[model samples]
Target: MPNLELLAPLAAALLAAGLFAGLLAGLLGVGGGIIMVPVLYYVFGLLGVDEAVRMHMSVGTSLAAMIPTSIRSALAHRKKGAVDEVMFRRWLPGIALGVLAGVLTAAFVKGPVLMTVFAVFALLVAVYMAFGKDSWRVASELPGRLGQTIMAFLIAAVSVMMGIGGGTFTVPTLTLFGYPIHKAVGTAAAIGVLIAIPGAIGFILGGLGEPGRPWGSLGFANVVGVLALIPTTLLAAPWGVALAHRLERRWLRLAFAFFLAATGIKMALSLLGA
Candidate 1:
């Protein structure tokens, strides 16, 4: 068994992270993967986990932990009529396929590569969110069937790879096409469910029996981390959902943008050895 001394501190840290993640999930339509990924990676490092398996574990654990948070967040938005049901239903097929591709890619890729992918994409989305306007119209509306499917696939793939949900990419994409930000955020929360379920499974299978895993690991997902995260996230998510509904759209956009930019830059710099 792992030392209780170490596990105790780790558990405390994860609980704190979970609370913050819950807020983001409900308020910003994320699955909390963005926050969890880096936090897990760092915690795993302290546990002396191998570099090879550390990042993958972080991603897997984040995905697994995100499931309930996403569900709760999505349901809250659904109740508010902010979710776009038609779009969400149409995107399901593409999202599942994308999750498969993304998980496969993550399984084979290096830790730094995954970090870079997450960092660069996050920066790009943050830029768009910061400067882009509500009047922006990429195609005067969301695309037709083929385009929507393709975009959905791309969004899911990127989100899974980055250990994020649809919010990091989807919200901006929808806004560019003239969808209201609230609707985009709500829809993204639902899409996160589609990505995380299969994606977590893939990570588990991929990392099963891999060397240098931490204590309480079932494949790449850490049981302690997952368990520690869930309850706090569940408790705090409703508060964020309530906040989301009351906040102005512009403020919401700015808050999300700033958070992404700071997190993305820090991750990118750390990866680059700066």
Candidate 2:
């Protein structure tokens, strides 16, 4: 067991992170993994986790937490009839396969390399969110079989690398293809569930036998983090869904963009050891 003195503060931090992550998931369809991964990295560092496995543990733990968070957010969206079940079904298989591939890759890749990739991708996502117009259309509707397979695989692979649910890419892709913003956000929440399940499992398998893991860890996923986060995330997610239904679309986009950009910058600065 961790020292009581240390564990108390860590629990508090995890709870706070969970609250914010849940809100982001419901409001932006982001699955909260983006926020959780970095937060976990810092927390694990404070606990003196080994540098070699810190990022891996963080990413894996984020994916595990997202399982429940995504489920809550998805159900909330489904209640509002915002989810597109058909699209989710169409994308599921490809995304699952991609996540498996990502797992294999992550098992061998070094931590710094993964962090750099995540930072760069996050920055690109921020740029697109900030400047990309809603009127942009890649197609009138979702692509056919070949295109769907390719895009879904790419989305899952990148999301796995970043320890994020697919929403960061999925919502934008859907919107670009002319889906309504609300519907896209809702659907993305559902997609998060798909990503989190396989993604978390992959991380667990990948991290098996790794040394210097925090106590109460199962593979790369930390039980302590998951336990601390899940309850708060479950409670907060519904509130965020409520807020999302009320917020204006433009304001939501701006807020999401700002958050992404800030996080991207923070990660980038870490690369420079700033």
Candidate 3:
């Protein structure tokens, strides 16, 4: 067991991260994995976890926590009749396959490479959120079956690599294909479940018996982080959904955009040894 003095601050930090993650999920229709991954990375680093496994552990733990958070966010959106069931079902198989492929790939990739991938993707997401117009459309409707399959695979693979649920990619893709913002958000929440479950399992199996993992780890998944994050995220997610229903969300997007941009820049700087 970890000493109480050390565990106390760690728990506190995790709780804070969970709170923010839950809110982001509810408010932005994101799975909060993007936020949680970076926070976990920093927390693990502070605790002196081996750098080799830190990013993997963070990614795995974030996905584990998202299992519940995504469900809660999805249910909240469903209550408002915002989810599109047909689209979700159509994309499921491709997403799951891609997630498995991603997990296998992540097992062999180094921490810095994964970090660089995340940083670049996050910066792109930030740029879109900050400046992309809501009225933009890439098509009159969602893609045909073949196109959707390809896109779904790509989205899941990239999401797993970045340790995010699919929203950062899914929402924008849906919207660009003319999905209503609310429906896109809700559907993304549902898709998060698809990405997280297998992704978490793959990470667990991939990292089994790895060296120098943090205490309370199972494979790459940090049990401590999952336990501290899940409950708070579940409780707070509904609150964000409530707010989402009642508020203008432009400013919230801007706020999260700035946060993501800063996080991306920090990770990029770290990668460049700046």
> Highest lDDT among the candidates is held by which one?
3
For model 1 the local lDDT of residue 122 reads 75
For model 1, residues 137-252, the per-residue Cα lDDT tens digits are: 87768889989999999999988887777777787788889889789989998898888888888888998999999888898898888999999888888888898778765776
Candidate 1 Cα outliers beyond 4 Å, as residue runs:
249-259
Q: For candidate 3, what is the total of clashing residue pairs?
A: 0
TM-score of each: 0.92, 0.93, 0.97
Model 1 deviation from the true structure expressed as Cα RMSD, one decimal place: 1.9
lDDT of 3: 0.90
Quick one: how many clashes does candidate 1 have?
0
- Measured with C-alpha atoms, the lDDT of residue 173 in candidate 1 is 86
- Each prediction's Cα lDDT score? 0.86, 0.88, 0.90
Give the distance in Å from residue 237's predicted Cα in candidate 2 to where it truly belongs: 1.2
Worst 10 residues of 1 by lDDT: 247-256
Best-fitting candidate, measured by TM-score?
3
Query: In candidate 2, which residue pairs get closer than 3 Å at backbone N, Cα or C atoms, i.e. clash?
Result: none
Question: What C-alpha RMSD separates each model from the true structure?
Answer: 1.9, 1.7, 1.1
- Which stretches of model 2 miss by more than 4 angstroms? 249-256
Per-residue lDDT of model 2, residues 63-88, tens digit only: 99989889989999999999988888
Model 1 lDDT, residue 110, Cα: 87
Q: How do the candidates rank by TM-score, highest first?
A: 3, 2, 1
- Model 1 lDDT at residue 55: 83
Error of 2 at 35 (Å): 1.0
Cα distance off (Å), candidate 1, residue 59: 0.5
